[model samples]
Target: MGKPFTVSRETIVLAPPEAVRGLLDDFHAWRAWSPWEDLDPDMERTYSGPDSGVGARYAWDGNKRAGRGTMELTGVQPHRVDVAVAFEKPFPSRSRVEFVLTPQEGETHVEWFMRGELGLVQQAFALVKPMDELMGPDLERGLANLKAQAETEAGSVA
Candidate 1:
């Protein structure tokens, strides 16, 4: 058994919470900003359930670098969205992901969080690449991309 791990990244987007939430609440919008989307140009994706709310679901399968996983929106609020992710490729694992959006002065404070326990496979993988080392960069890059997307959309509309 491996220890529990949590990874979080935050950024201030020059947009309103609603604007940012629209991008995150809908998995389809992820194509505009999700860092991992570039991993495989041909990644196969499937969307099901409600269009983009609490029951929305997304599944993807691609090359080794892209891996395979399913994400489901479990909850959504004006300031928060929760996702349950199950990965099944290279390795099998599950994690809970959260996006917290807070409106400040005129922008939105977005925090991305993920938590999960490292199973035997991940425990061993940690010996070589700790959770933070493996996931931190991705989380950071994702936030940056999200920030740019939100700001760009907000700008075009203004």
Candidate 2:
């Protein structure tokens, strides 16, 4: 046994909290902003449960970079969403995913965070360096993409 490992990352989207929350609540919407989706264009996706909110589950199977995993929405609120993801195939691990939205100057400050206990193999991989370092850039890019899409949508509506 070893200490549990965790990483947290956040970004501000130039849109209202409601708008940002709407985007995050819908699993299918992730394709618009998730950097990982670009890793496997041919990845297979499946969704079950509700269209959004708690009980919603989405699974993906793709190449090594995208891996294979299932994420289920565990909690949802006006400005936040929580999910649990279990990876399979290439590696196995479970992680808790969260999205927190706070209104700031008419824009939404979106913080995406994940935490989980690393299995022996994952722990060994982390020894290479801080996981946050590898994940932060991807998180930033995803947020940036979200911001772009949200702002574009807002502009179109206005």
Candidate 3:
């Protein structure tokens, strides 16, 4: 087996840690800001466990780009969330998702990281094309959306 690989992207949002943390807490709320949601608007989705906490799971089945996957909240901290996403279609692999929030000059710096085990198929695909290059843009878009949403909400509240 090859070493585990990771892809990470982050952005600093102009909001407080608590507000940004709330956005990360609810998987359903992700529709408002996640770039993946835009890829397959008709994807089948299901939620189980708590609305926002450890043990919560969000599963989806969609077209090729969206793929089929399940993401479960596996860990949590005061301003962090750790999720594991298992892809079942288009390819199969398990990836870890992490959200970290740090206070900076009254705003929050949010960092999102994803690391995982690449299956044989995905590794093969990566041989021809790097997944990080293909997926980094989407990650950036997601972070941008998150930043916008958090900042907008903070502005409204203040």
Give candidate 3's error at residue 46 in angstroms: 0.5
| lDDT by residue (tens digit), candidate 3, 47-122 | 9999988998999999998999999989888789899899888777788889999999878878888887767877
Using alpha carbons, what is the TM-score of model 3? 0.93
Mind giving the per-residue lDDT tens digits that candidate 2 earns over 1-158?
Answer: 54476666777667788888777888988889887889888999999999998898999999988999999999899889898989996788788888899998878888888788777776778889666876778888888888888877767334
**Whose lDDT is greatest here?**
1
Residue 142 lDDT in model 3? 94
> Cα deviation in Å at residue 138, candidate 3?
1.3
Better of 2 and 3 by lDDT: 3
lDDT of each: 0.94, 0.83, 0.86
Q: Give candidate 2 misplaced runs (Cα > 4 Å).
A: 156-158
Error of 3 at 24 (Å): 0.8
In candidate 2 the C-alpha lDDT for residue 127 amounts to: 85
- Model 2: lDDT equals 0.83
Q: For residue 123, give model 3's deviation from the true position in Å.
A: 1.6
Error of 1 at 46 (Å): 0.3
Model 2: which ten-residue window has the lowest total lDDT?
A: 1-10
Clashing pairs in 2: none
